[model samples]
Target chain A: MSYAALDLVMLGAAALIALVAVVFGRARVSWAAAGLALAVLLVATGVFDNLMIAVGLFHYAPHSVLGVAVGRAPLEDFAYPLATALMLPVVWEAVGRWQPADVRTVIASSRPISWVNTAYPFAAAYLLSTTNISVTFVVGTLFFLVPYNLLMYGINDVFDYESDLRNPRKGGVEGAVLPKRLHRPVILAATLSTLPGMLYLLAVGSWLSGLLLVLCVLGVLIYSTPPLRTKERPVADSITSSLHFVGPAIVGLALGDAAWTPQLLALLAAFFLWGYASHAFGAVQDVLADRAAGISSTATVWGARVTARIAIVAYALAGVAVLLSGWPGPLAAILVIPYLLVVAPHWNVTDERSPEANRGWKWFLWLNQLTGFGVTLLLIWWALGR
Target chain B: MPGVYLALLLITLGCMVILDWRYRLFFWRGPVRAAATLILGVVFLGVWDALGIGLGIFFRGDSPLLAGLTLAPEFPVEEVFFLVLLCYLTMNLYVAATRLLSRRGGVGGDGGNPS
Candidate 1:
């Protein structure tokens, strides 16, 4: 069987497990939130994946696909996000069953808005590197889309519960102020959910791919966990957070057995810089909250003004880095302009007023969608040239 | 005439520098940081371009205005000026835009420490 077929079966199984978990789990369900998440997933996947396929960024073998199309995307493409939308809340709700009082809080901590962030990188990288569908691609995509995020953000919610309670930004879309009672269960859930996927991936992946996957998981753990909480280390915090995103792509490249070309390296470097700048800028909004909680970060250490300036510099450098990736790639350099503009107004924000940067952070989220569209256009151009 | 593109690029960069100094946009505020970012940016982009050229994704398009000078096979001298202009212009635009917005009370208006 082709990778697409295997991917569909695994996704179906995952969705079923999540559904059963939600049905049995005692945690209260929010039909509204679930419906909203599903709707967003449908629209995003239907639109973006269809466009990517239509433009030929990558294509599935005719026999490998199910022959069903939603716009230009194969029907199978929707399964990844659909499974994610279902599995995340189900996992959260199931875990929350252990601490009934914190059920609502755990559900909110899934950070549904950012779910696509992890999934897209893995799916896009894998698809781009390997023109053909394979089981490794499917398995890797499923892992990153759901369990990887659960381990990354779920563990984060548990570990940061104390500081989250004090941060005004918590208890909402930014994060969930997970209660103390739910901490152990949340950690248990994250570990339990990720272990199966990790083992499956390690068995299927080459040694290089397995090592990169391990590093990716380790990045997620160390960024939030104690003693080695890299998030508490100013500049290192940005680098680690950046790795959390870049690692998945690296793993995809390794699994695809793609040759390391200079242009590819340049693109990865540019992506890394963009990720670092994003994390650093995001920290600016939490400067006061972090300092108040005795949590050190790039923003708290350098002060918000300096941190914002540095973020701008990093963004600019990212744009320059992209310029060397060749024709259509150079066009992506323009994408950074929007991001630079979004953070530009907060240039002089002091620590006391750093929270005001949240306004820009909000815009940053939407800017990501816009920038994603721009990148898609460039990808389409590159594909057309090929 | 072969070096016309390079010469024009340098002249445009010079104009940008003049404007930046007159407006105290970037370098005037933090010369050290600005210089460091510029140098790092140029070096990184240069290496990236060299790599791309080496990998054969990039090739210098022939033109009468081209410098006809080679940094390496398939790599052009004009690329250096282009990278410098890109970094210089982006930094200047970023700084000038921020200063303008701050003055307009669009950002950081509460004495830089608004609680």
Candidate 2:
């Protein structure tokens, strides 16, 4: 599986620099700082996705080869990291350089080079292609995922208008808000982008794939705009947001023409756990804004303290699901147990309004990522037949 | 198979229209937002559809509610129908849960207080 020897070294360098950038500020350093950050970014994504694919979690046709095939991993998977590094910084820069203060500001402003915004999600999907690549996958991405994300971000901005006005830094007002008028245009863009993919699927006689695309388009529309503005409500908001995370991975079932297996089910379960944990914990940060906006998020309804607890439990569940997927050994499982028991139990009790919960959630989120990585390694090992 | 497809289409359309009507006629929120909600319903269905295909959970066997679109041996048109209908109901239930909790001013300080 040791493909792309040079690429691996570059990725290592990128990771090292990213560590420095995180410690200091990226702005304080040169473009080399951002360059280094970008380098390892896509590599990390690709390696992970590639490992997942090789382990029967999913599969992807290699667009390129780097001469390493441990079971079925290709050298091109390394490019995913490079792509991520590039796209992430692009988005970071775009949001910082071109964002407006409000929806009106966004609508009125004539920003140059705004198309760069599309790169991140595209890269996200493309990196995802390390797992599965089909016309349906692309359609699910451009039309459904990207549009839904933009709309969700816009609606979140709209709802948080007042809170955002009060706390500019935290709301992180760096992107243009999708104004009411732009709603249809965004949807139209999403819908139109899927046409080629859809047509390809139709021609291939993959009617189910085409149907998935149409349905995904419909899903994004309902979540963002109006009478259903589901995000205005609590649990629905969480579930809708979760679809964004899990929906893309749905291609797993179609990959390599395999049936849905227990391992895939475990991955989906992990997806749900992560989704719930992210929402329950993430909502903690926005309780005040969500409340002011007439939104009933879990953080608002359950209280941040309870929400935090739920997040911990959800995180724990995700960890367990990963463990049961026959990857990480009992030790890795044991490693996370203490944190789940000790740290998570007291995350938000004393100061619901304090940033302590966010800090803890961040830690736990890392644990989540670590578990994902560990599980990937384990799956690779499993594919190797122990 | 065709009958199953027709049934599923009807169920899905029915759910979409109902949810759309609720948002459009009852909520009085903007049309854009309402449309977004319906789209969301569809997105959930899509996710479920994908997962259903992937996980083999709750698939149709000898009997299906709808027919016509049997692209795969394991799936029917009604499968998509069930995905959409089930997802629509699930989303609505979540919305209701949020609403009910908000109305009670249950927890989380003034944040929980409904408008």
Candidate 3:
């Protein structure tokens, strides 16, 4: 939301457009000439942007930028001419054309219904801690809402496309199996969209929040991609998945500058446990299909019955964890009861019968809405009382 | 106040003109087309400045170098001159780049290569 951050976003966009023109267009732009043009433009920008700043034509919010200056000008101002040097020639060359993506498919790939699951935690934590809507709060909420979800699920869908193709439960709200053609765009969209908000949040938030945000993003990526695909690892998978949700809440709190009281720690512990249990429990339904598709997860390694029991135990422990959070915090312990009940039906579910756990998972999905509503009421009551 | 800012802007504008004429770049290369492009650039950037000023992201500084002249509230007359220099400089750089590149392709005629 700072001028610097905004400028950086525009600069990135301009750079991307220019790259597309050079790479994909028939313009045949000379790299040597472009580099020379860029060098000259940057030098002129250094002089004139500084001069303009000195003469009082414009100024930036000190807190928003990196505070590195050339003479008197904020470094952010150079992005203007940098962008011009990049984009003007591109406009002349090809008008920066690219293929259109299937917008609906990409949105479907993001699991739109579950957007609130991640966003709610951040908004609640930041709003509760700060007790007012700050720029960080709004930006963070918007980020966690769409781009974060897209980044998380888009990567998963792209990587999991083959496996998901074998699963009948996919191609709907659970998560559509991304086509191979859309893979590049989905990944591109996820990354390109996430960076601005991510950078903006990093700029505005405390160092603690920045650290948390980095770890959280890494968790999302590592959960699905590469040799470090934590989703293929057993207990690590559950832990990483849990962090995906709990990380946002903690980041929101840190960004809001909330005090790290014992009660807050206890509350986070319970939220972490809830996420931990939910991921393990969700994996239970996919055990049979995942094993068939040659995927390894906690449930696939542990088998369905054991994984269900483990999840139920974790849920119960989550309820116990909340009791340590003081009064209204303890009230959230009640919200875990429904999850326990939903998973109890799947306790003795076998590998062949594991697909039946999908029924419980479906119910569990709707159950989350009720749980969110209950948590919101409790937060409001707590906020009003406080 | 003296028109020191305006004078500086004019001098810089003169330098860009000199570069253009000496290299047969920009306006010297093609008068009507370069004029159209440069004018369009200034108008575009002038609108950009207006947007920034309207949004309170831009404000005129209280410098003695600036003239005691206001084209509009918080907008000084010198800004018009400044915009001209910016547009003219960009055009010159772009045209010179094209010239340097095309000349390099052909035998000899490295006349305007700034390198």
Candidate 4:
């Protein structure tokens, strides 16, 4: 079980694959940029000792399924960057083949890993399950982790069809652009997929899970369909969509047998705020398209400058709420400091601000999950108070 | 205070509906999408609570925060309300993030030229 034995092998293999990916992945990227991105992915996925140590969130179990130390980060940890580097390219390739002409002009402009939020958590949680896992937990986890994602993406596609068709923001993984006509099928499939995840949970005595499944369906349905399409509204869209971000985690925590204390609630709330702040800031990049499309987003309504400021405030409040949740010590609070630090400079940014001006904000948005993970570590440590 | 919370939820949902009517979320094509979103929001929390209860993470509190709902361990019904409330927020976050990364005038992506 000791990862030390497999350390050399895993590293060599990972390096080789990454190298090959770079060589043939098309969309040529610089080695250093790739390396740097790789390193960040490693860190973000818990591959970096520096982060693990700084936060006391996760310890090197010394036991890894991969049979390699892999730098003492859990073997499950590596899935993050690996998944990102791999999945993004795969999707990118698929999208390109489906629309080669547009691929070069727009989609290929950016890398999927650079744009898509890391799905590592989902990967890690799903991949690390024990055979002893109860049917209820399995069902619940599946419900939270699987079907909802399909719905979220499907609905977004339905809502954004016009924009994606009109402009086709070509850069990175430029969110999948399915045709408007296809929205119904996509939504229907997504809805159908969500049921098993929930129904399975309900069958196992987790009635609350049934409720969650119901809500998941409702949320996706509402977010994608019209008359109540929350996606088009300003504050409403952002607020409603933010649900998918925190819902699973909250449920996961409770499912883990961690009591839903005020501390836990506040922690979850802080994360929600962080997610919202990131979401709000995220809209700034699309302000032009959204405004043109007449989409009412916080960035448009509050104006980019005001929205960014609000994001900053929201982020700050989230951090403070986390800190006030009776921190185990300053160290725990300090662990999250880096996340806040990363986002601090961008607080004042506006859409009018050049890309150069807002790069930090964008980076922080992607990295915010690490902040959440960092907080989770501190909270667990505090709860254990070992 | 709890009444205020309920009022807020109603108001927020109402406002979102009205706005959707005006702006057309999903181009105002399907109310079911929004319904799906809301239902999913509740399901996420309810399932989580059940699992949390099973896992020993959450407990019921005697507080009158969310009346009529059972609190598991020390958690209040209000806490559950917040979870759904939070779903609203994070989904927005994802949309927003997607916009920035996908839209123009942003880093867009890793800038495939990676020079």
Candidate 5:
């Protein structure tokens, strides 16, 4: 990574964390003091860095820098002090505010079970593409495994809590529920914890991958937040949810600089179709629940039967798309058969009888693990062949 | 010349200690909290430095004005001491400034009981 890029990421993350600490943690950072610190630190850096560099202590790779200089010190060298000035006080304040139960609550709200659903794609994509372990792979996978889910499901649960407060059927459903008191903490924790990993990934990635990462985060936000709660929109709901899973894979592929071939595109298209299909299928179980809650979804809008059929078509098309993936990719096509079978039994599922589809949704969950295992084998074969 | 860099850092750090003791500003005000914050800052900066080194954005200068001992490749022994001094200096400046600002009606106190 370029020194400037890394600096930018650190600078951006520090500034954002500082802002969030002020807004939510109510940390009162004295800007004037920070300024004084920065000014003094910068002068020290200018004097020492030049002296250090002039002594031949280290050198920079020719290809990895922008050639920008402040005397002998790279302009990028200043970010350490600048970032420190911005971030340390917030860390000081947060250290005082740390609580144990809040940690447990944040973890609970992240939906531990569903964490694998998002992490697998990113990890698999990066591992398969790069074929080597590096910091990006480890950090990105961990990010996807936890903080990413925390942001996705944590934010979702917070909104779910609000909706469930008015939900007469809340106690009827056994799932993670965000309590009212934990709202601000959840949002703060989710956003704050996501910063380091997200910023690092953004810095290391190409512009295209960075855009995809931003879209992935935006997908998480817009799906839950108001004015564009795509979660409540009819067809957009499944598309947004699909984006949630597929987005991470695309980001990983982009970061690993995977070649965008026809086979890869076809495979991704299949994955995309599978995602929306699974999402629409999952919506069937909640048709009655959502209708009761006055929430609009593909199932509530088109009734359970049409939604189920659309899912079957999406799965079948996903299989077709996978066939064009070449070599071992064709073997992965059979994996979608179980998905089709899961939704097939519910082909005639009606709005009044939608709750029964929850059984199939249960099958869908385990089927994912099985499918994941199958896909892993195929990916290994494909990677070895390459 | 062998320990010029390390000595400079220690002297600078001593100055910060004096400032803190004289003003009751950072470590003198709250030893535990100040120590924790300074440690956190050092760890944070250390990680950032490690990442930069891993990415090949940083290189160790083979300087003669330093101890030959190293903590890691390109990471000199002075680096840790430098980080400590940097963090301590920042805290002293922050606490002193916050005290001054609060006296002038700023929202944040100096993170201690009101004097």
Candidate 6:
């Protein structure tokens, strides 16, 4: 019933799923790539999670945790990255066995660089609200960290493979140009991979949390999948993408049984706006490629220059929204300036030159690291009473 | 002396501007674009501070280094200077880093030459 027990169950289930999918799915699993990915994820999760815990941003109840500490994180924490490392490549291999190519493409689609984007929000919200490491917290964090990303990006790679083929930005860290035959298996894998975590989460969470979780999954699904593909719907695309990142935090807060305080609402609003700006700005770079492939995105529909302007406005609004969170939250508004500065140079970038915005987009990636550090400091300050 | 923190921040901002001017570190090499970027950044951050003040998350710290002048309840005048400095510093660093990488011929579509 405790988090430690649930952690063990989920870990076993994830490993089992990965094993069965790889074995019976008739996929070629590269031990070297899988091993490297697992090592890297483990080290990253250990370092970042420990740093947050050390700063008193949150803490784990000793009994609920497995008492096996790697730095400050419990042994159960490794299960997330480990499960992801195991599951994704096998899924990729299973899905794309006809191609039988390098595992690098799968790694790229997994978006290791942005794993913390989903994981951090869930962990922070759940920990801040509950202040206890419960089954819900563990399940939510693990789910967001791995299965959530698998579903989000796997489906993206599958459906967007055609556009990605035309996009110079694909086949690397930004995205993966998955082969055509892998499409069905990838979708199946995404669904199957997420099922166990989803079931466990629903079992442990309330109706409110379940609803948020469903919305989160729906956002992931509709954003990339055809027929209901929201990513091609202009402004709605940005809104849905934002939901993909912010939904988990809402689910965390709800599952933690946190009150709907004005401060919490403001934080969520700010977070949502930030997500919108990030996706919009990201869309700017893909305007040319998306259009070439007959896709309709916020950037493609509105044109690159206008989308960039919208992004700036959204980022500014996000900063303002965060200010409503009060004292140190006001200090956090300064963090938005970096994003503004990065995007400002491309203020008038044309569709022909939108690809140039990739330079700023690259900085945006590193900027997230810096901004995350700044937010961590602000969180510590808030936790320590200004 | 109460404004020493603000003074240091201004000095740092000045240093970054001089460096940028001398090195053309950021793409907004022209004074007009740079000034525009800075102003926009300050305004957005200021609005954010105002909202935080309204929501009651930001309170002026009890540091003697603060100028002790209130822009609003729990809002200090020094924050403006601090934010300006933050915006300027980030711009300079981003441009400088990008320039350095591109100069080394390591820039790729994703920004860094991953290969």
- How do all models score by TM-score? 0.58, 0.44, 0.67, 0.49, 0.73, 0.59
List model 5 lDDT by residue over A1-386, tens digit each. Answer: 78788777667767887787777666656677777777888898889889878977667776777888889888888888887788777655654454556556667778777788889999999988898877688778888888888898888878877566655533432346667766766776677667767766776788999999999999999998888989999899999999899999999999999999999999999999999999999889888778777888889999999999999999999999999997899888899998887789888988999889889887876898999999999988888898
Q: TM-scores for chain A, candidates in order?
A: 0.74, 0.53, 0.82, 0.59, 0.83, 0.75
RMSD to the native, candidate 1?
Answer: 23.3
- lDDT (Cα, tens digit) per residue for candidate 1, span B17-100: 897778775466445435534653454345444433433333466556776787656667777777677666555544444444
Clashes of 1: 0
Tens-digit lDDT track for model 3 on A273-348? 8888889989998998899999999899989989888899999999998999967989898899889888998878
Best by lDDT: 5
**Candidate 6: tens digits of C-alpha lDDT, residues B1-115:** 4776668768877897787767774323534335534543454345444433433433465666666786655667767776676556545544454445456675411132321
Q: lDDT of each model, Cα atoms only? A: 0.70, 0.45, 0.75, 0.48, 0.80, 0.71
lDDT of 4 by residue, A1-386 (tens): 23333334333433443343333333232333334444555554463334433333223333234444455445544543443333223222222222334322222222233222323332222222222345344455555554566667656666766767654453225456665444544544354445435543543434554465456457656765788888667777767666656655544443344455686567667666766776776676667666777777777777777776766677777767666555563344454466467556666665666243346555664565565466457545754663
Candidate 6: clashing pairs of residues: A323-B51, A323-B52, A324-B52, A326-B56, A326-B57, A326-B58, A327-B57, A327-B58, A327-B59
Clashes of 6: 9
lDDT of 3 by residue, B1-115 (tens): 5787788888888898888878777667546445534543454344445444544555777877788797665678888887777667665676567667777773222235432
Q: Give the residue spans of candidate 3 off by over 4 A.
A: A1-78, A84-101, B1-115
Best by DockQ: 5
Best model number under TM-score: 5
TM-score of predicted structure 1: 0.58
| CAPRI category for model 3 | incorrect
Please give, for residues B1-115, the per-residue lDDT of candidate 4 as tens digits. Answer: 3444445555654564464455443214333433444444455345444543444433443333234444443444555555454443322222233334445454433332211
| TM-score (chain B) of candidate 1 | 0.86
lDDT tens digits by residue: candidate 1, A197-290: 6755665568998999899999999989998999989899999998888898898888778789888888888999999999999999998888
Contacts from the true interface found in each model, as a fraction, amount to 0.00, 0.00, 0.23, 0.00, 0.49, 0.00
Deviation (Å) of B76 in candidate 1 = 56
